[model samples]
Target chain A: MHLNYYQKEDQVLLAVDCIIFGFDKENLKILLIKRNFEPEKGKWSLIGGFLKKNENLDEAAVRVLETLTGLNDIYLEQIHTYSKIDRDPGQRTISVAYFALIDVDSHHFDGIQIDAAHWFDIKEAPNLIFDHNEMVQKAKARLKRRALSKPIGFELLPEKFTMRQLQNLYESILDKKLDKRNFINKINSLDVLIKLDEKDMSVSRKGAYLYVFDKDKYEKKVEEDGFIFKI
Target chain B: MHLNYYQKEDQVLLAVDCIIFGFDKENLKILLIKRNFEPEKGKWSLIGGFLKKNENLDEAAVRVLETLTGLNDIYLEQIHTYSKIDRDPGQRTISVAYFALIDVDSHHFDGIQIDAAHWFDIKEAPNLIFDHNEMVQKAKARLKRRALSKPIGFELLPEKFTMRQLQNLYESILDKKLDKRNFINKINSLDVLIKLDEKDMSVSRKGAYLYVFDKDKYEKKVEEDGFIFKI
Candidate 1:
């Protein structure tokens, strides 16, 4: 066989860990699960699973997220790979961390109680097991950067939302207050949002105009005009 | 034995591949090596090696890059991880791709003719084996994006360079023609460059002023003022 070249190479377990982000119209939250296994039993940890031989990292991440959350087709991005020799004390494992964004009210948890999993406001997240804490921090930083340059924030917002709602989402992800006028100017400059005729009157008697991210138009503009999205 | 939790997990071979970029004052280039072993013998490929048991991915990447280039302290960034089934014909391997930037003239190969390794202009590089081409493309896109928002381009240039040199480097990486006036204004607005009292008289009679990236000042500004670098 022509396999001698790779015969002596070390094989290590590959795991996929997910940092799932949710926006409940007010705060940025992360989903975490309590460990049920021996190494770190009862400790908080990111939802994760080992990669099977047939599936790729992306598939593994999606499968792991779905298995834990009972949700499907969530927006997942592979952020970074962690490979410290002793990262996972129970085994020699390298984990590829993925971040996902979901609107809190939009996705249902398939009517089953996921007792181990719970949502934590990003700021109040408990200490996670292994290198999972570092993984969450890195994923959060990536989310902040992506939110600034891409229209990804829309994933965490309802289809129709007021401008204040959009700014609030950005503020939560960025962890800082943005000047409202400047925020509006920048969003308008992107020219990828559609102002709908409907208004959200729940918060105020003089309702605020609602807007939705026009993904199709945004993608078409990027393809045809080489539009680079930036905030 | 408390090992049953992870005993049945699949372990696969891991590899580290590097997309090494260099600039020789006039153009951007990539380093490629001819594969000497089986499965893809004689094919051009990125410098890569199998991961070992003791080292983390970063250390493994640095070791692999140093082994092939005979250079150390090169600036390396982990760009992405590739894990598609059948990616490597000889074995199932997950490869983490890292991109490195080095000033071509500043470092010399430790003097034994590494005839297998060569630098090709970024635009003129040959077809690479086993998804290496895709890795290169992704790395180039990252470099372009990083150059616009960070001072990383300085790693590919001499300590002091003329404004035209810096602009050329950006143009080459971006693969676009930028307006000279706009490029200069944007770079100057970042306030991370120190215009030297000295001038480079090599290119023209009325010499252009040379500038050095002020790393210390840039860091201080970022720390104290929360300055964001953009160009």
Candidate 2:
């Protein structure tokens, strides 16, 4: 399989950029890392690294995550790729954007090289480097769509979360007010959650019951009849 | 501006692949071309070409679509990139998949060369080359989601379409048997359609009224208040 026909085509640098989405109490935050390289040195940029040899985009994303956060084994999905000729001013590079949702407190960070990684409130994010702001916008759109159609939002929040936290997470991502009753009705109709005999009273006087996604039951039901989790 | 640090990294081939979706009457079809190149010659493949020096990914997608359809100015969007190590059995190449919607009868076939290009009924599409089938599935999923949340479905269908045709298109894409009365009620409630007096008598004796999406009105109303067109 010779496959050398495209060898002479303009070979441009490729980057794997990650948008780490995390949820804190009420607001959604995006992780930004200070660029250590010369092109955008010290400027706030997405957590990114050049795709290394022998690594595919997913592995590259995981490597980027591990390099920045000192953590692995997270949910990362390739959202879209940005390849405008001038997206990166320093060179003609194509960047494949991935969105990763990790529970904020789950991954530990040692006091070392990973200090540059910090979570910023999505609305208050600093001026980003290159076309990263556009990437964030696109990632947010994908997150919103995924949140509505699937149960992936649970990945961003804590494993055991109250119903209010879930609702707030949706509202933060969607930037719209959702009726509590209507939201609960819609979510409950999906029949994919398991109510644990636990309550979290941190945010309210009357504690809310905690729930965890029943993965096995959900997977079975999803296979039997597509359990659409409409938001 | 010295990118010398990355000069030694693996410079793999990059290509833009397109899933051209077209709607004929009520059938949702995708335009696919047979591969005539070495690695997978004479097999069913996606419409694709390698990224050029001066062109971006979107530009490459447009170029590939124009080259295949012999026409320019089509609606195309970058869905996701496939970067699995063995996705392309011939070599380790990264492919950015773009999904496009084109009017069925509007493309020009002049000056286009390669293996045969034809529309495929999505469900019955043959075994494609490499991971092309997965790309098609993702594109169809995006199309269905977009159809429900935006006015993209109208791009695939003709300017004027009967309610039954539109409903059938939705049914075909979503792979569900929707109740006719409920489907009509939901679409009518959207208030973005202009119902003409013409009836489509081709499909039935009673016929259905012809309607075209009022672009200006739909744009205006969607801006003022979000719309959800569902079946």
Candidate 3:
């Protein structure tokens, strides 16, 4: 194919922005970075970078996340694309936004990069640079919708978690207090968890039973009946 | 800002392809045009064009659709962006795929363009150029999911339609047989429809009551409580 066919078309910059979501014991937080480059020099912003010539958007997103967080093989989903004419003041660049879920305690943050990156509670995150705040809001909404039908919430939890911990994670993400009995009932109906023999003794004297997500069973159920994990 | 800042980066060609969906009485169809340009000339393909320098991706998609259908303000949604390195054979181009829903009986088709553009039942659509077949599959899946939670199915129907026509639209898009009684029960529970005294006798001897989607009521209900219209 002749390159001249596309020569007349305008070539624009493409960037990828990552909305890193983390869940601690009490809050849902987002990983934000302080911009150290021109155009937004000192403002808070999403961890982002321009797409390279040899890489696709997903690879660019993964590279950006790995460069900042020192994490690999994390849960990442493409949520939306932002393409306003002046979204980026530096140029007319289009950005693909990805939402990533990582356990708050699992990743190792580079000390130098850690100085610029911080996990802020979702509600407390400051106004971000350019259209990044809008990107974060869209990612959060996608996360909320996805959590209702998929077992992706497990990506935010540790390998072994207590029932109360699971409920707290949902309540934090959904931003609503759920009835304990009702929540438990709905989760049990999904039948995608393995109740372990051990118990977590840190939160209470009696201890709540620990449960782990049963991936095999979930896949089987999904294949059998198009199962929807609703809470 | 100096253009030299991004001059070293490899600029890529961006294109937008529209999956135009239309619903007839008994089938769901997609509009595909025969490509008249090189690198797959004369092959059936989705209506597509490269993004110009001054235009956003959405604008490009609308331009492509309007050029063929001469319709504006249709229900167009950005479904996904395909950026595989070799998905397009002609060049390293990233295509944003949009799914548009149009009332088949409402839009006017230009006679000259109609000679090259044809509507094919989605299931019977010819092998499309590039990865457009895959794009259609992805858009169809999204349309199925969106129809269940949102009232977007109305976009494929006329302003006034009968309950039977509505159920048929859902069945065709879902590619399944639905229990009529159960479908009506679910739609009525949502309480977002106005049953009119008028009747449509075209499909049956006795005529079914016509209904119109109540956009205002639906929005109000959505605001009051997080409404999930499950079928």
Candidate 4:
């Protein structure tokens, strides 16, 4: 089963690591799991797995995310690939890092497989094993850049969310205090949200009106004018 | 030397393909080479090579570019990874695609290694082998995105370039006509360019002033104010 052309080449382990990001009411969080294997056993690490022979890297990332959170159809993006020679102490492995956004309240974990997994505030995340911390930093920078040019932040919010909640998500990701009036003006200019009669009563006495992202209008705008959703 | 943990896992051949982009006065071009080996012999393909055991993906990419162009310290970026199982017909090779920007006139080729290489206008590029076309498309999109957020357009331009030449590079990358006044205003707003007194008289009777990208100012601005060079 050996091929002559590839015989002299080195074949190394290829793995995929997921920087699963979630948003609660107050802050941004990341999903971290305690490793159960050797060479870095019982330490916090990004939820990752080796790529299977039958699957592509994207599929492997999805499988890893599903294995941890029992969630399907999440918003996932391949952030970057880390291939430092000594990035992994145990082996010369190249990891393709992916960032995923999920609504925190909607997807509850399946207890059996992810007993060691926990959500950590992105700011207070524990030091991770084998370049996982570097992966997190890169993913966060990518998420911030993406949040500016695209409407991907909506993926971290619930289906119905208030404008203040959306602003909070952006502020948390960008880690800057945005002018409230300016933020509202910019969002209104984009015209990608639809206001609903329902109210989010949990936040204030005079509840803010709920809004949903207008996917149809967004797609149409993108197709027609190449609209860029800049914040 | 088989590790017990990796005994049952699959290992595939990893390769790196670089889409080398160059800018001429009139249009953008790509460097493509005729394949000299099996599985795609004699066909036009990207400048590429298999990754070596000791080097990481970036190093492999740099090596491949240097082999073809005989240049170092050029602008190179990893665009994406192509891991479709059947992408390479000769073997199950996963290619990490990179896009490199070089000044075509500045870096001459090393004759012996790049005998079959040729520069083709991006619009008139030939059909490439084994999903290379898709890789080129992705790289172009990434370059466009990067050009907007960073001062990467200067990478494709000569050190001392006229304002019209700079605008043309942007128009070619974005594939749209931008208003001259608007574009100039935006560039002026960035304040990351040094206008030189030297003029280029090749294009018109009244010469256009030349300018150079201020790398130090741009870096300092990025560090100080989180500057985004949006155009």
Candidate 5:
């Protein structure tokens, strides 16, 4: 049974591009893979793949990211769709851009060895092909906004992190120097962190106390009083 | 030159759905058109059309809106793209949903005599076709979030609107009863309104002062100090 009611409508090739963000306790980075095939072969581009008929856009995005990093259950969000007619010179393709966050030390790339894939600091990333650079800039802007309103920055941090490390993550994502006292005061007011007795002695002699994100408490607060996470 | 390098991928029909939100002075309304075509004909759905091979998504949305309402130079935004595979049972169609704000009293539909079109209050809107109800919900959520971060509610107002009218617009969109004094205080603090000597006498015996959104001042403030419009 061929149900082709929209035969007159023009069909388009859709692709999903993933802007994988990771934090290395110092700087924010993005995973980019060298395009193996032309029109711009060997150029560094966001890891992407064409959407198949059997899968939806989210599934396609997940598949594309998994095919490169071999990681699942990552925090992925569909940011925007780029549909300039000539966005892709090789063909008329509309790419749905998704941003994913991962903790650098936790997610090891042990699935598949793609020598072309490399992680570059967001600031030093080379000019990508097509409308990919635009996509990156848009994704970064979305990440910045999301960081202010949501606790998504935890996705890019380890399970147990020090206050300084968390503050550094914020500064990196926001690309601004946040006053130390003010940042700590705001985070403390959120009341979504479990301050552990253990201290991280790696950064300084008088180590800082580590903390883990209290997801249960956060959920409870949200359920009871409609808590909004704002930075 | 016929460039067909990527022929080994699936192609899907792309559509753009417009969630046309209009303010009828007191309540937020959405303009819906009855689907005259197959599968779900006669059912109310967001005004939409299939994307042509020539135009981009934004252009496609603008054309779709104009084809129905004959209005141009409207404030339009690409909200999100829906791709649930079975979202459109007519075909494997991916629809990009855009939410447009229009002043209901100002923009008279004089272009096309589409008898099927009607405006329904947001709360009283009918169950839309396919995943349209979902699209509407998402668009409304986006509108609520955007209204808090940006001064987009002004797009749904007339050139000279009373403070009460502006408050009503916000209340309608937020679906909440706001404190009048607090709301006025916040709006005044933003300093983006020019309180004119004219008054809106239609609403009450004691006429309220009409204010016009000072775009020049807002732009200057934004340019000089990166002022974020938050309500």
Candidate 6:
């Protein structure tokens, strides 16, 4: 079965990088890895690895994320491909950047020692390695646009959250002010939130009522008529 | 000068398959090529090619479109990457799909001998060669979503287009009946269109006012305060 039909064409390595996004109470943070490879060794970078021959791109992304964060079955999306000639100084490689959303408290992760991997406030994140800064910027932009139309924000928040918590997540990612009345009014109109009798008493003495996202109701509402969750 | 680190890593043969989207006076059509190579010889396929070492993915996509249709500098976007194992029987090829919108009447193309490249109405498009049909479907869905938020539909239309033609393009792609007043209201709010002094008497007796897309004004308006062109 060995043949020369493919022998002439160029063969190279492909890599997958994951931009892990997490929402902490009122701020958005991205999980960044400290590089452990040559050419850009000891610099802050996204969690990434070279793709193996047998694995497809999706499988490679999932494998890299799992190997890095040790979490599986999380929400991940392939956002864009970065294929500049000198994108990776180590070699000629094309990378597909995937942005992932996860509930911060849900996943358990161990930090890589010496080589620094930690959460940075997205607004004040450090200058990243290589073209990773550009990838991060693109991922943030995609998330901001996606959050406007879909209920993906829930993925970043805990299962049960206060309306104020949800609004703060929106404000942090968009980096702009939103009218409190208008924001709450928009969310309430959607009618996909199940108000719990419990209250989040930490922030204010006059605690805000806690609410859980009703996925069934959201899907039903979408099927009946499209609803844009704009803030 | 022949020292170390100047060597390029093994480079993969990057390929770009453009889902060339076009809208005629009536239906939506996609441009395709009949395969000429050994693995899948003589099969319906998307217009595509392997990237030369010097070019970027966008450049490769443009080159393929131009060589196939004698057109260049088309409106294109990299939608997603297809790297499923055995997705391409020829080799373990990683192909990136670009969604290109073009005006159907502008290009004067002659079919190649071995490659029977042709345009088929979206409804009647044949079963494409490989994973191309899946790529086409994804591109169409992405285009439909994009048409709502952006004024890219103008790229698929003639320079001075009637309002009816614009509305029909949306309806055909989305396969939904739109109310006249509601559609007009949504479009007017975006303020991206410049109503020309001329009228197109061909479509109707009353003559719809021909409109052109104002790129500069749209950019300025979006920067000042964003507007969403919802479908």
- Model 6 per-residue lDDT tens digits across residues B1-231: 211332432334567899988888567788887776667777888998776667677888888888777777688899998888778777777899998888788756753432477888888898887799899989988887666655656678888887788888888787788988898888777778999999988767988899988888666654542335656
DockQ comparisons of all candidates to the true complex? 0.51, 0.42, 0.44, 0.42, 0.50, 0.40
Q: State the lDDT at A157 in candidate 5.
A: 87
Chain B TM-score, structure 5: 0.92
Give Cα-based local distance difference scores for all models.
0.85, 0.79, 0.82, 0.83, 0.84, 0.78
Off by over 4 Å in 4: A1-3, A219-231, B220-231
| Model 5 lDDT tens row, B108-193 | 78546267789999999999998999999989988886666556556799999988888999899878888989999988887889
**Model 1 stretches with alpha carbons more than 4 Å out:** A111-113, A220-231, B111-113, B205-207, B219-231
- The residue-by-residue lDDT of candidate 3 on A116-208, one tens digit each, is 999999989999999898888888888776666555557788898988888888888788898999999988887889999999898799988
| Model 4: per-residue Cα lDDT over A1-231, one tens digit each | 336776778887899999999998568999998887777888999988889889999999999888776878987888888899989877788889998998888888883457888989888999999989889998988888666666655678888888888888988998988899999998888788999989988889998899998988755544432234444
lDDT of 4 at A173: 93
* Residue B118 C-alpha lDDT in model 2: 79
lDDT value for model 4: 0.83
Which residue pairs of candidate 6 clash?
none
**Per-residue accuracy of model 4 over B126-218 as CA lDDT, tens digit each:** 999999999999998877766666665557888899889889888888888889999999888878899998999987999899999998976
Question: lDDT tens string, model 3, B30-53?
Answer: 999998777888999998888887
TM-score of chain B of each: 0.92, 0.90, 0.92, 0.92, 0.92, 0.86
Give the best candidate by lDDT: 1
Question: Model 1 shows how many backbone clashes?
Answer: 0
Return the lDDT, model 1, position A6: 90
Q: Please say which candidate is ahead in TM-score: 3 or 6.
A: 3
Task: Encode model 1's per-residue lDDT on B70-136: one tens digit a residue.
Answer: 8789988898999999999999999999999988889887522267889899999999999999999
- Tens digits of per-residue lDDT for model 1, A43-152: 99998999999999999998888877798989898989999999998989999999899998898774132788888998899999999999988988888766655555
State model 5's lDDT: 0.84
Output the worst ten-in-a-row residue range by lDDT, candidate 4 chain A: A222-231
Interface RMSD of 1: 3.6
* Total colliding residue pairs, candidate 3: 0
**What interface RMSD, in Å and to 1 decimal, does model 5 have?**
4.0
Fnat for model 3 comes to 0.31
